[model samples]
Target: MYTDSATYNALLDGFCKCGQIDEAFMLFKSFRDDGFKVGIRGFSCMIDGLIRSKRIGEAEKLFQKVFDVGLVPDLILYSIMIRGLSESRRLEDATNMFRDMIGKGIVPDTQCYNMLIKGFCDVGLLDEARSLKLEISQHDQFPNTCTYTILICGLCRNGLLGEAQQIFNDMEKLGCSPSAVTFNALIDGLCKDGKLEEAHLMLYKMEIGKNPSLFLRLSQSADPILDSASLQKMVENFVDSGLILKAYKLLMQLADSGVVPNINTYNTLINGMCRAGQVNRALRLSEELQLKGHFPDSVTYSTLIEGLQRVDREGDAYKLFEQMTENGCKPNSSVYKTLLSWSCRRRKTTVAFGIWLKYLRSLAGHDGEALKLTEEFFQKGDMEKALRSLLEMESKLADFDSAPYSIWLVGLCQADRVEEALKTFSILEEFNVVVSAPGCVKLIHALCSGGKLDKAVDIFLYTMEKGYRLMPRVCNSVLQVLLDSKDNTILAFELLDKMKSMGYDLNSYLHRRTKSLLQHHYSLRKMENVAAR
Candidate 1:
């Protein structure tokens, strides 16, 4: 009584194309379970739907199901399948499947080829990617503007400016006048390469002519859409590249465009001003934003507080912190971190500890780690009393995720208790807490200084295997111990060579000092040989 299967499948396919993924899947499932004839198109539509929804694994399962049901995967099907795999970084499987498709006499379409080439470029396989482009050109269907743009952008992103520009030049020789997209890509590449003047020149040309939305278009959704927003982003890019006047002009443009500056927008401007050491202008903007009914948020206060702290205005920072709370805005982790950092800089340990405790005690639900950390800090002076308080809190709300592993690790390291630090490090592994490189470095450095060189070296090797970069200070400490003997000195050199091979420059001051000492030993040996002669 209902429309035929093709008609229904067509309707479902349309639904998928329009982003109604849930509805399409439901319809497809209903068609299958009800014994309706679901053809290759139906299967492909469902697979495409799943891929578009970012359900790549599910799409892969569906593709296998299609093969199991004896449906020959078509070009569109293979293209979509390859796309899903490529986007998820399963490039090897994608390449194999694509080759298999070619063997089946199903030559890939332009989009499919582009997808594979782009995937290779994404993972920095530039030479292989260029080969694909050459293949496309030989086939008399050289990739389109989008394909060239993607390749250029990818090459530029990988810092292969020479290759990127060569591709662009090839495009020109091919008689393809550069579009707005091409221009934007080049400008962005220039910006990345610190050629702000060139980027600005390109941007200036766009202003005098098309004023294309390509730059804004390149930015994905969740990015600001309006002209002002795009201009603001451009300003941010320039500012990040140390182009202050460029940012200022763009900020003024936002005002001229009648875009009402919100708290965040104002905060950004004030932060820029504060960074330039124009505290008076930043504060003036803060008051201006407030008068315009856009009151300063915690960030605004934090920014000013940081500025005050920078200029030795600790009293002013405290006042701003109090004012922020009075304005019904609670301080964030950053605010307390900044305050404590300032206190530490001024050697005000008591003030730092006070701020730390206030930040710790303010925690409630989902703050077990902070509370436990506070307990550990208090433990050094009063362990029995602190443990009792911590145990009581643990009884009420205990979550394994919020255990004081990091806190105890830090506390143990600070107390110079190597045994306890190692124990805490092991305990952290038991809790599945990811200890960062800095945390491990601090511990290893402390252990090395305490003559626990073997233990420290073990930890450093483990950290290195885990792809963690050791701090120079920690590496130097380990190197010092390893260079105490001739055999150890050779081992130290081997380790340094390994580090260099891993892309760490061993030309650091500490590394050079160790090298000089080793060289001195070699000179002493040569001098001894001459004396014997």
Candidate 2:
């Protein structure tokens, strides 16, 4: 093979294109050593290969050598140098090189402009990136899909979601169809911002391939642009945001679009529906999912069972638990805990005991240690020791859930250990355990009965602050205790006003009693004033 300068340049170009940078570099060095004058074309190939290999310093030296060799760099060489510098995060150097390219009468194309914009965006210089995007149009070059997508992605990453959305809308108006990457970035931003409805609508548009105008009307619009998305994640966001109905509707749309949701998605919807007090709707959804061949997993069963129990449908919950076992979906520790906690709260002693037995049977030997300590402490009437042992076992075994701690708090309150119960409640709170509403109410009432009026008021206020719904009787009892005390009448009135702000209605008896007490207090004050006069 009689290799000449042209043949050497061809080999270099081929090696660089194929990512054989070392081979390309060695061939270039050998060609130079053989006294073959390397043309600007050969230098461009070598520089591009060095840049691709992340050897920016070496590439810059080669680029400088082109000027020393008295060869004015062409647009191809300048473009390669600018792209290399921009990608290496040397934005200033890239910008200077870009200006130099123009100074030498070499006009840049849209691709060159896009490279600079991406560099700006990569470093969160969104304002600069946006400016470069505008510059593209001024240079008689329209911003392409790549350009807009880069800017949108950068804006979204910087939490400028509103601007990102506007850019997306503009991209659509200009007839640039958004790619999957663009949609994913925008959807993810919306989800993170808690804009569940917007995220859902955007995801629907992406999956269904509807045009902007038609999507606004949600009718038959543009051609279908089918793209894959994190549909389950969007459902989760909807559920987490308390948009249960919206999540349900999203699920329906997903199904209509021939996108099959997994059982996890159904389970999330069921949990959200149950929490929103739409237990009946949740059950219907369960049936719908089952019909669609998405059988309920243990999570689905546990969520529905808890939802049923929440609505006071204990029999339905029990039946579902049996169905879960029959379906071969072994109820997990969570399911057993749910049954045990609810049974104990409802004072179904036999049911709770049975559930506890089943829970123990379901666990391996060591996993049941904390529960056994709970049982032993309860049997010996040692609530403190029981709680202590449970905590110790939890630190060692890490198998105890919030259920056993809640049961102990309720039991302590029921046993009239109000002080101990309060301390236990505080410990539970420190551990981020949510005590049941019934347990809170019982503790509050017990505190009132024990002549701990201030403590009782504090507990009541704490529960109210946490958004726990208590019976009117609890409020009335606290108000009665406050009004009965000479020093706490003002507190009673303040509590009444606070309750009003919280949307609680005072019963007629308390209202009348408050009025009578105020009048009586005024009458006594008037008698004292007369005596002083």
Consecutive 10-residue window with the lowest summed lDDT within model 1:
399-408
List clashing residue pairs in candidate 2. Answer: 209-225
- Residues 113-148, model 2: lDDT tens digits: 989998999999988898888888776788889999
Name the top TM-score candidate. Answer: 1
- Candidate of highest lDDT: 2
lDDT of 1 by residue, 103-215 (tens): 99886766778898889988988887777777775445767777788788788888887777787878767766666667788888899889999889878865666434443
Error at 483, model 1, angstroms: 2.3
Clash-forming residue pairs, model 1: none
In model 2, which regions exceed 4 Å deviation?
A: 1-258, 268-281, 284-291, 325-337, 349-374, 377-388, 395-404, 407-441, 446-479, 485-519, 522-533
Give TM per candidate. Answer: 0.42, 0.40
